[model samples]
Target: MKDHHQHELDSRYRRAALPPLGALRCFEAAARLGSFTQAARELHLTHGAVSRAVRSIEDALAVELFERRSQRVFLTAAGERLRDAAGAAFDVLAAAVRELREPPGAPALVLSCEPTLLMRWLIPRLPGFHARHPGIALRLVAGGGPVEFDGVDLAIRRDDFDWGRRVHAQRLFEERVGPVCSAGYRQQHLQGQGRGARWDDGAALLHSATRPGAWADWSRAARRRLPAGQNQSFEHFYFSLQAAVAGVGVAIGPWQLVRDDIDAGVLVAPMGFLADGSAYHLLSPRPIQAGSVGAQLLAWLCEQA
Candidate 1:
């Protein structure tokens, strides 16, 4: 009686558009391994069951996932693309499961900042940070502007920030600004154009729209002035640097953000006179413990500065 009812329920579900989760899993595994037998063994199911699951998934998606020939199943181009996405989904699911299984104790460290800052500055130094404090786990939350810090632990801010009633406040470090361009670009246009050359003397300046006064600052320091009719603007400093990298123009880059690029010989400064301080602040709701990872990060940035 139970088997009959189960069969009826399964038939009803099959009539619906929803494909079985097990079938999707089997297909993903089969595509990754390029063999039904291998997928069956890994999934602890019979080879026939695995093959049926793969076929079911392909039919549901209306896409050809594999091409079988000479007793071997090879994933199609579509299957290869799907495999990467499926694998990523599996990883996220597994991580979520693991987190649920573990007992929760300390609050997760949620770091909010711009994508450029995270990619160019923070990510490279994260290895040393992990080595020193394995207990601290980081969640990189990125955006163009600051999000309301309701659920966030800390913010690495470069914009206007209001402490309001928050208990946390510390200056991370100031970012020094200077002329930065690809080494190739520096050698080409800026080569014979050093201290003797006027700023407007055929120098292609990459303007950053975000930092309104960067050109003015650079012009003053370089002992030159931008022509009244000259105009160029980029949405962000990151994009401005990218333009500079492609030899489009010379950009004023923040030392804190592009230090590694400079060190790696990817970018170089023609004149070092533009290194002026612009503060970046570390903000949170409350003060961290003296020896905590938050404190460590603060200390590290200061030392780097």
Candidate 2:
């Protein structure tokens, strides 16, 4: 009788220590998707429902989980911790279900990368990787900023933000940036100008919303003045680069992303690239084994870089 009573008390304590499962599910969805609206859509719930559920979790925990900025939301440090735990828990549950349903195949190496770099540079080079290593399966996710590596095997990021010291980071390559424009735009606007000439006031300047201070950073590095021309802003860095390719205006381009375009004569970088004091790094939760697939991928990436 005493053992039974003690077991009941233990069960009650465990239940009390855990948050409501529904609220936790909502919080996990919001954190993974990075948007309340998207989470609501995925879960077939109203936006208000998702918001209230997340709020309930926050209220119970007495901590803010997300930083609301205008129309976007970002996870806080505490939120990231919860996200990692929730993601790992969900992944384990999912894998168990899959194992019951079917035989397991080769485990995929999940790699998260910055969207612009993935679109502009990595995707173009992925064919070679696949061809070289036919046995290794890859699952790529596009993201930036702080990463939750619970379910993710690897992350490729520039050393622009502090991603904490808990994870092992392997430096991949130096990041070099420069102003690039379509060759046609250069012929029309800068035909007779020297490489170090100040940007022409008549030409437009293409700017990326993601990197608002890119031009300013380049100006400081090159010791040159920016143009007093009309500025056009794009929602993403890739959009700005595409606009530059279309002869819309000059855009700050990363060397690795624009190297092929420059070589193909699609774009011209009159002022050569300069190191922007940032380097790309591969992040992992644990040290990679020497002969593992992760190590092979890392070695291949370094060779490519």
Q: Return the top candidate by lDDT.
A: 2
lDDT of 1 at 229: 40
lDDT, candidates in the order shown: 0.70, 0.85
RMSD of 1: 12.4
How well does each candidate superpose onto the true structure, as a TM-score?
Answer: 0.60, 0.65
Q: Can you write out model 1's per-residue Cα lDDT over 23-91, one digit (the tens) per residue?
A: 879988888787889999999999999989878878878998888899998766466546644654564
- In model 2, pairs of residues that clash are none
Candidate 2, residue 83: the lDDT equals 73
Weakest 10 consecutive residues of candidate 2 by summed lDDT: 91-100
Residue 15, candidate 1: Cα error in Å is 30
* Runs with alpha carbons beyond 4 Å of true place in candidate 1: 1-105, 144-147, 159-167, 191-194, 197-200, 227-231, 273-277
Question: Tens-digit lDDT track for model 2 on 1-305?
Answer: 56988999999998898788888889999999999999999999999999999899899999998999998899875786577557655654553464455545678788998987876677668768878987777777778998889789999999989999888899999999998998888876663456646567877888988999999998999888887889999898977887787788999999998998899897999878999999999999888889999999999999888
